[model samples]
Target chain A: MRSRSAWTIFWRTVLGRAYPRIIGAQREKSWVFFEIFLPLLQVTAYVYIYRAIEAPPEFIGFVVLGGAMSAYWLNVLWSMASQLYWEKETGNLELYIVAPTSRMAILLGMALGGMFATTLRAIAVITIGMLLFHVSMTVRNVPVLLGVFLTTLVALYGLGMLLSSLFLLFGREAWHLSNLLQEPVSLVSGFYFPVRALGQVVAAAASILPITLGLDAMRQLLFPAMLGDLRFLPAEVELGILAGLAVLFLILARRALAYFETLARREGRLSIRGQ
Target chain B: MRANGSRSEALRSLRVAAWLGWQIESNWADPFVFAIYSLVKPLAGALILVFMYAVIAKGGLQSPLFPGVFVGNALFIYVPAVLAGISWTIIDDREHYGMLKYVYTAPVNVLTYLVGRGVAKTMVATIAVVMMLLLGTLALGVPIRFGGIDWPLVLGSAMLAFFGILLGGVTLVTARHNYGVGEAVAGGLYLLCGVVFPLDTLPSWLSSIGRAIPITYWVEAMRRALLGERTALFSGLSNGALVAILAGSTVVLAVLAVLVFRLAERRARAKGLLDMQMMY
Candidate 1:
């Protein structure tokens, strides 16, 4: 009966962790500074691009929205994941692991901290984008944009928590995996210009990543009139794809966590050395 | 013996340094793993840039200034990736099982000890830089030709080395435990310095801020060095004066590094961080 209660508690702990991963709510204001820097350079990049090209007003809005959304998701998954893995490798995980709280709570604390940091960066870059590029974001697009952002955030962080578990299971293999996440997704997500900008294969791969799907859908909503070419892909298509990948990632994440816990109990620690 | 003793002691420190810095010991990963870590980011980063460029280029952003992503990346885009590569070295000393505390307690001069460690870390990082450059030139086709450099390139190389030392010193002192902040600063500096666009490409106020960083100086120097585009602003300065000033700045930087070393030593000693090193 006591063991049943403990298992029930772990499930509850995970649901608690989901609040931030899903709702995008962490302690506000205190983390506003970190967001300032991430967007600072990105907006500068966009303004530089805008001046070089006389794209339609709509296109500039597309750049601002796409860049902001993608940067947030990319930082959450890429930078945050590796930072977590490094903390684990340096034996920082021992502290969190030994904490009287649940594993879900620890993952929530670190990942939420990272997500918040990245979000801070994303918001700063968006402000810069708006000021520099003269982006005109409309109220109509905000609801859909928020929807895509929140859902993708859940998917990406879920992937992150899962990836974090892998380090616990496999150790050093986690580092190698971290490198593979961001750059490839950056290409795929079409952060700089358009999906048509990448090769067909690269574009296809980017379309598969949740961040890319979310950004593409958000782009379509922002530019609702141009449904013809689907250069950025359609909204429902992107939402469906993003939602699908997020679920697939979560299920696989749970499986990976189970294997990792078992492997760690048997092996003592994850290997930091690459073989 | 006394007459020769002074001269021998000078030579002996050299010998001691040579012995200490040259070895690959239990802490060999301090250099080796970090070197491997440093090289991977740029190779991956360059490809990511190529992807971003491909996207923007296709999106009809192409113009004369379009090289901002492709050509400008050689100066700007690669810095962040390279920073991520050197990620592990920030706390390499502290992470070693009590080795930092042991290092702090040693009778050897703190300057000598850190210099030895720096020499080791720098050697590995330098090798990693070379490998990334080669990968950029040969494998990735990044137009960062060492041979194509002219007068401007000469000044640019000095500036890059200057920035490298500054960053290395910062790592030794600040954010040693949290390298991500330093890495972000390095990457952000590259973007702000207008390596992709002219400093005029950013907001007027921000571009002025970017000007103070050595990045714009080096980026212009690199372009003039490699591409041989002699802008009037750059060509107006006497090459000899620029060289002299840059050289002087570098010497001052080395002095600053020594000060950072002293600070690191004091911190390690005060905090009992040197209790972990074991020697035969």
Candidate 2:
């Protein structure tokens, strides 16, 4: 009975926290428009570049898929990982740390809220790309695509939660750490082109990033015509690897919480604002 | 300490502000991290464009158009560094440090003070610019012919471009102080300025907006002046015409930004909104 009540309390805390954030995101109408439109403009630039050099017609869809997937990664870095930094600045981290609830509950709230908000922008980008650029997508299996995408998000968010602890421990001057993630991740993940387009050594190095595997699997499943030229593993193998990574990162995040708390307590770094 | 401020005294204050700006930016990180941090972003950006060129052309950096991508992305480093140093630095001062009121109340004119701050930012950005140029030539093997250089034209075009960025930064920072969202404007400029692709391919309505932005002409003119190659995306105009257009735009925009900033300062102070703007 006690365990049941604890589980119930945990979920209630998460949903209660996430509700206002999701609502607040909608309240800022201009930010919502900017979020959707800015990414589409970025994708449009790549599409036009491809047009100039006469890349394969299907590369348009590839670029669109890559752009949409990358929005989730951005959310992870900004809304999930850097969230602890903002909370520290805003004085909420202190209250949460003193509270009785599990730390993962707070991150769970962030992940759900961020994913909810980012999905809207991602969907808008996809729809706009289809209408404006006429990107060709041929889904072979709906269930498989859904599975791969969800698994990828799970792994990505787990990594984000792990990063949160690191950021929390580092405090304010470490914003460069998050900035370090963006462009390198985009480049390594092959956001506009396939990883194999890079040489073998680089491709092997890039495969370490789960998003690269995720994107390749997604493109292969959604556009089966590209399957003949698949650079990474098959969809099932990629999805399985992503699932494994999800578990691995979640375990690491749990360990990171303890490690970060000890470090923060020793260094007296908790809730140090604007360092 | 006279009631009437002398021109020399104001200039001294401006010089101090510029020095302080440079010091604060440099001290943000340790020297080692700062150097590595500076190189990573621009190099990664160049790699992205290089990868795209290779994929589309079916030959790695062997494409006829690779030189354009190489130089374009290298020069694109100045956009974010300069724009952020101007607008976001002000936003940070007012919002994070709560220093804007004191800055405004200082004896130095705000326009002169901002121009001084801009000079400091440009100095830091030039380091990154030179690094990018070296990375492109030495590491990436981008074909920049030394013999074809137009030294005077390049210098003239560069000055106007920097001036245009300064005016845009002033306008953006003024808006930021009043209502917030300076970062979004900076990000929007990165996309709209014809940095990587040509503005001509955009829809006519969007291209019209591009036509008004001075950075469009600046990037085009810089490419033509430095490389002696016409832009494949936009701006077929002669270098002289491009420089003339950018200079005129800078004068008009600088005057407009000054007026707007003055009005915004008055209104913000009147309504007691200086501190309140940070809540966003």
Candidate number with greatest DockQ: 2
Model 2 CA lDDT for position A30: 66
Alpha-carbon runs more than 4 Å astray in model 2:
B1-6, B58-60, B145-193, B232-236, B277-280
iRMS (Å) per candidate: 6.6, 3.1
TM-score of 2: 0.91
Instruction: Write down the RMSD of candidate 1 (Cα, Å).
Output: 6.2
Per-residue lDDT tens digits for candidate 1, residues B237-264, read: 5555555555665566557755665575
Per-candidate TM equals 0.73, 0.91
Question: Chain B vs. true chain B: TM-score for each candidate?
Answer: 0.61, 0.82
Query: Taking the candidates in order, what DockQ does each have?
Result: 0.24, 0.49
Name the lDDT value of residue A71 in candidate 1: 60
C-alpha-based local distance difference test score of model 1: 0.55
Task: Give the best candidate by TM-score.
Answer: 2
lDDT of 1 by residue, A113-139 (tens): 556656756776777777866777555
TM-score of 1: 0.73
